[model samples]
Target: MTQAIDRVRQALLQAGHPDTIAMFAEGTHTAAEAAASVGCSIAQIAKSIIFRSGETPILVVASGVNRIDRAKVGAALGRKVERADPAWVEATTGFAVGGVAPVGHLAPALILIDEDLLALDPVWAAAGSPSHAFRTTPADLVRVTGGSVANVKA
Candidate 1:
């Protein structure tokens, strides 16, 4: 398990992202759990959510502080945004739903970032493991994940 995490970290580095990844014994399956483990506000955690915009998969890195504004998302993209099922998440990301990272996925997705994350300097994100997470700036995440800054949240 540690070796797998190391690989994920290496992938992040190879992708030109800062290597500030951290692992923990407790699972970061939820924002509250991650906030407790990382000792940060729950709002600082970025939830890597996969939603289906028609047949295409769009990845939304939303702030833990707010939920996605489905109507706004639909309006911006011109398609209805339906929350992707767990199976779809696994299929698209190669990682489980709760542990999905913004990068190193099995398939590329249309990425939209929560503009609110910009207010938080160092944002916590999943690290390809349920028990691991990392802190990095939202701008760096956008660059590393090839995501665009957008008003993805309500």
Candidate 2:
């Protein structure tokens, strides 16, 4: 218990989101598994995605059930958006691909939130660990991440 809390705290501090950080082990890595562990609907999970627009990296916090439309992303970012590989995700976010949180990242990323997510009452986000996640309101996530809520998909 202490170790989990400590890991979460360190991750939050490193990402500059110490106030909003929470962690718990899900015993699995899939979004479905996480939602089950956290007692939430799978759609409530926000999947963090890292995409590259040339040399610039952008982070998208999208709903679990939606797929990001590349054309829309490119239009929004005003650049060609390509799905970044795991290495790029890790390099840019400091968290593993499966555990990238909305607010805590190794570096500042151009963060975008899927507008659909705002409709959910309590959204779940990763907590810097593949097996962990937490619940928070969409408004709080938007404010803490400084993310612009937008249509991220079709």
Predicted model with the maximum lDDT: 1
Please give the lDDT score at residue 70 for candidate 1: 74
| Best prediction by TM-score | 1
TM per prediction:
0.89, 0.83
TM-score, candidate 2, is 0.83
Quantify all predictions' global Cα lDDT against the true fold: 0.82, 0.74
Q: In model 1, what lDDT does residue 115 have?
A: 85
Please give, for residues 18-125, the per-residue lDDT of candidate 1 as tens digits.
Answer: 787787777788888988899899899998888887667888898887888877777777778888899988876677877888877777788888889989978999
RMSD per model, one decimal: 2.0, 3.4
- The residue-level lDDT of candidate 1 at 73 comes to 72
Which pairs of residues have clashing backbones in candidate 2? none
